[model samples]
Target: MIKFELKDLEVFYGDFQALKGIDMKIPANEITAFIGPSGCGKTTFLKCLNRMNDLVEGCRVYGQVTLDGEDIYNDYDVNLLRKRVGMVFQKPLPFKMSIYDNIAFGPRTHGIRSKSALDEIVEQSLTQATLWDEVKDRLNMDALSFSGGQQQRICIARALAVRPEVLLMDEPTSALDPISTGKIEEVVMELKKKYSIVIVTHNMQQAVRISDKTAFFLLGEVIEFGDTEKLFSVPKDKRTEEYITGRFG
Candidate 1:
């Protein structure tokens, strides 16, 4: 099933075009990786899925972006849209609070006030992020005290706390060590069974390892988009071939 469909998508920051006309269909319950060089608009396109780009000053988007066949930019509630599409950033951004509170924050904001309910949510979210066992006994500990990898997992748990239908990760493990990166990858692999995941990564090998579908961006447009294995092995575009082979970004 298609989770998101984009046609003639374009984005501009002030007068500078950041993304040219682009088109792609993201499948449901699978990992879609956006790979490209710096400033290739991979992150820009990911933000468009949940209207995060709208937060940018002078950011303008033109074209059709639909979620579940409904135009997200047309008379949609931004807050509710965000609830359905949760985001995890490049860096671990845990609020200055305990681990339990971090996971409970989203559910609380959405009107889950019961202590028992919050308890279940916190446990489930942390478990989903694969941090439950390590932090279960210390749920009251400050989230920031954890290591970078644990902090990132906490952020993931926070995003999952809202029970989002889709998860958007922007270089989620870029700052973590290899072991940490592997853990995040493992969590993401499991998440695809329950959530449609879209990730923007500079790591081509990571893309090859996790994603079911891959989109290669260049300049301000998509050069190739298809099954992950095919796109990497038999790229239809020379630019994609060169970029993946490390000839030129």
Candidate 2:
């Protein structure tokens, strides 16, 4: 199933094109990784998926991007589109509230008012994010008190509570320790069973391990996209091979 269809996607920041006529289809219920060196537009392209680029002044786009066959740009309610496409950034940005409240914020904002219902969502979201067991006893404590990795997981839970159909992660584990990275990778593996996931990563091994498919980007162009095993082991593009083999990036 195609969760997102990006066709001839051209992104520009004040006349400087970042993504040049890119075309891709993100599969439903799978993890797709976009990997490339800095300035290759990997992150820029990821931001386009959720229209995060719109937040930046002078950002412009050409071509069509659809979620579940509906044009997101054509929709007047960007806020509604965002609810279906949740994003997690590199830094773990938890609100200055308790862990429980952090997870409850979205559901509450969307009209989930009952305390007991909020409690169930908080617990379920935390469990899905693999952070409940660690902080279940400290729900009322400050979320900032958690470690960097824990904070990121809390953010993930916060995103999950809204029940997004697609999750966009931009180097989600970049700031974490190895153990924390592994834990988040495990969570990513589990999440693919439910939500379609698109990740932008600088960590080659993490991309290889966690993603079902891998797309190589360079200078805002998709060099190659294929199954993870094929893309890493036997890339069709010489550029992709060089980038993977460390010959060039």
Candidate 3:
């Protein structure tokens, strides 16, 4: 099942073209990793999925980007689209409020006012992100007080709280320690059972470990995209092989 389909996608930040002719079908209930060097269109492409790039001034997108057969950029309600597709950033940006409030924020914004319902969402979201056990009793504590890794998981939980069908993670564990990275990887893997996950990662090994499919982007184009194992072990494109072998970015 295809969760997202992009055809002839191009993104321009004023006169500078950030992405050119991107075409890909992201599968449902799987982790798809976009791997490339800095300045490649990986993050730009990720942002397009949920129309996050629309927030940028002078950023224009031309082409078709559909989510579950609906045009996300054509007459779609941007706020609702965002609720259906959540995003987590590179850094752990927990709100200054309590942990419970952070998780309940989205639901509250969506008009879920029942205290019991909000409590359930907070617990379930945290559990899904694999942080419930550690912070179940600390729900009222300030979310910023946690360690970096825990903070990242809290961010993930906050994204999940809205009951999003798709989750976009941008280098979600890049700032964490190895142990925290491993924990986030495990949580992401588990999430694929219920959510279609798209991640932009500079860490190729992390991509290999968590993603089912990998898209290798270079110079604003996808050089290769296929099964994670096949793409890494036997790349069809020479540029992909070189990038994977550390010959060049």
Candidate 4:
């Protein structure tokens, strides 16, 4: 099933065009990776899925982006859209609060007030992110006290608390060490059972390892998009082949 469809999408920051007429369908219940070099608009395109680009000053978007058959830009409430599409950034960004509070924050914002309800959400979210067993006894501890990888998993649990249908990750493993990155990659592959995911990554190996679908972008355009193995093994576009072979980025 197609969870999101972008039709002739274009984005601009002042006079610079960031995304140029992009059109693609993001599948449901799978991980779709956006891969490209720095400044290639892969990150810019990821931001468009949840309208995160709106935070940028002087930024403008043109074209239609639909979520679950509804026009996200036209019919959906920005706040509601965000609730359905949660994001995790490159670095761990937990709130300066207890681990329990960090996971409960999203549910609280969505009007879940009961203490028992919040507790259940926190536990469930953390378990889903595969961090509950490790941090189960430390619910009251400060979130920042954990290592970088643990903190990133905390952020994932926080996003899961909102009951989001889609997860937008921007280089989620970029800041972690090899062990932590492996943990995060495992978690991401496990997450697609219930939620659709879109990830922006410079790590081509990571993309191939976890993503079912791959989209390669260059200079604000998608050069190739298809199944991960096919795209990497037998790219039709010269640019994609070159990029995959490490000849040029």
For candidate 3, write residues 99-218 as lDDT tens digits.
Answer: 999999999999999999999999999999999999999999999999999999999999999999999999998999999999999999999999999999999999999999999999
Tens digits of lDDT, candidate 1, 52-123: 999999999999999999899999998888999999999999999999999999999899999999999999
Pairs with backbone N, CA or C atoms under 3 Å apart (clashes), candidate 2: none
> Could you tell me the TM-score of candidate 3?
0.99
Kindly report which residue pairs in candidate 1 clash with one another: none
- For candidate 2, report its TM-score: 0.98
Assess each prediction's global lDDT (C-alpha) against the native: 0.96, 0.93, 0.96, 0.94
Ranking by lDDT: 3, 1, 4, 2
Return the lDDT, model 2, position 118.
96
Stretches of candidate 3 off by over 4 Å are: none
Q: TM-score for all predictions?
A: 0.99, 0.98, 0.99, 0.99
Model 4: CA > 4 A from native:
none
> Per-residue alpha-carbon lDDT of model 2 for 1-249, expressed as tens digits?
999999999999998999999999999999999999899999888888888899899999889999999998886478788889999999999999999999999998789999999999999999999998999999999999999999999999999998899999999999999999999999989999999999999999999899999999999999999999999998999999999999876
- RMSD to the true structure for each prediction, in A, is 0.6, 0.8, 0.6, 0.7
Clash number for candidate 4: 0
The candidate with the higher lDDT, 1 or 4, is 1
- lDDT per residue (tens digit) for residues 1-249 in model 4: 999999999999999999999999999999999998899998888888889999999999999999999998886799899999999999899999999999998999999999999989999999988999999999999999999999999999999999999999999999999999999999999999999999999899999999999999999999899999899999999999999899987
TM-score of candidate 4 to 2 decimals: 0.99
